[model samples]
Target: MGDNEAPARRVVADYARPNAANARSSITRPAIGVNRLQIPPQIITMVTNTIQFHGLPSEDPNVHLSRFSAICDTFQEQGVTEDACKLRLFPFSLADRAHAWLESLPAGSITTWAGMKEKFLDKYFPPSKIARLRSMIQEFRQKPHVGGDAEAEPGDNEAASRDPGSADTVTDSVHDQRGGTTSGEPVAILGA
Candidate 1:
């Protein structure tokens, strides 16, 4: 049988066969020092929105991490089991670009919620990458055009027309290194 195939039929067959009294006792016995605790299943009654890749862009790992933490908190608050949490988080990627990477992993590679989270952080927000992004954000500067009006700054307009990617040009949409919309206003990176 393939490694991925379930052993349900074999388990059923074993259970269906009649066993001798000694064999039954041996099969039903629990090992010493092993605790067989049964936890009650929790019913998720609240309707919570699922996290989607669209909401988390690849350039914003810090924001993605924050959002992921919130989702995990919500899952815990709703009484989702650890295993269930791992399964639930599989569909939710921290970034749109990461979705394919996550899908490419072998089935059941991430067996626990903690393991999945660790893998995600290691892949997307490595220490060196995070530091580089932070440096870029810190060095970012916006050069506002003189006179505040486009009509008043024909020279600046002409310069912008000549070099679209010039450092002196101010963009209408100023995205920080973490990809958060600053709206030209400076914003502190979360968890920085």
Candidate 2:
């Protein structure tokens, strides 16, 4: 190769290309069945109105996921799978920081509804948060009732025991980090 022509060589540093973020989606779309399935605008609007997660510290990601799943359950198309419906409508429920977090995920990383749920919970409801909640549950103690009569009558106690939904009893909705309630039973406390 002549020096004047410059030997054909590989360029080590290539010029920057256009950003592809806008062109690609983080969540993978399900394969279209025999008939193409589409979520209705009304369903999207309903989910948006009912659930909004901003990724705030106060927001419970589990609760948000549960609620979102519930809303997604309301509508079902013949060709659409449950996860397909969830994956489609889940994005509309996110706002502010939550939406940003979703956008930050790598393109095509989430292929299934399970993957999306896992990623969301791993980000928002981290292990540290779960530990903290678990610790709180372990350290929970009922505070003595004030202002009201400290001691209830024997008859009142009997009535409260018979009625599972009595005001005298308090039930803790301590969510198990892995799934549903830690224990589905109510923690009974007698007023004293």
Q: Candidate 1 — what's its lDDT?
A: 0.50
**Deviation from native of the Cα of residue 88 in model 2, angstroms:** 1.5
Q: Which digits, one per residue and each the tens of the lDDT, describe model 2 over residues 1-192?
A: 666897666554532555565477788878756377778888888878878999999999999999888877777788778777787778899999999888888988988999998999999989998899899999999998532457756654443344566543323212333255566654443452
lDDT score of residue 42 within candidate 1: 31
Please provide, for model 1 over 56-139, each residue's C-alpha lDDT reduced to its tens digit, 9 standing for 90 to 100: 334555565566565445534243354554345445443355666675666557656566667777776778887997999999
Against the unseen true structure, what C-alpha lDDT does each candidate score? 0.50, 0.75
Clashing pairs in 1: none
Q: Candidate 2: lDDT over CA atoms?
A: 0.75
TM-score for each model: 0.37, 0.63
CA error at residue 178 for candidate 2, angstroms = 56
Question: After TM-score superposition, what is the CA distance of residue 54 in candidate 1 from its true location, in Å?
Answer: 5.3
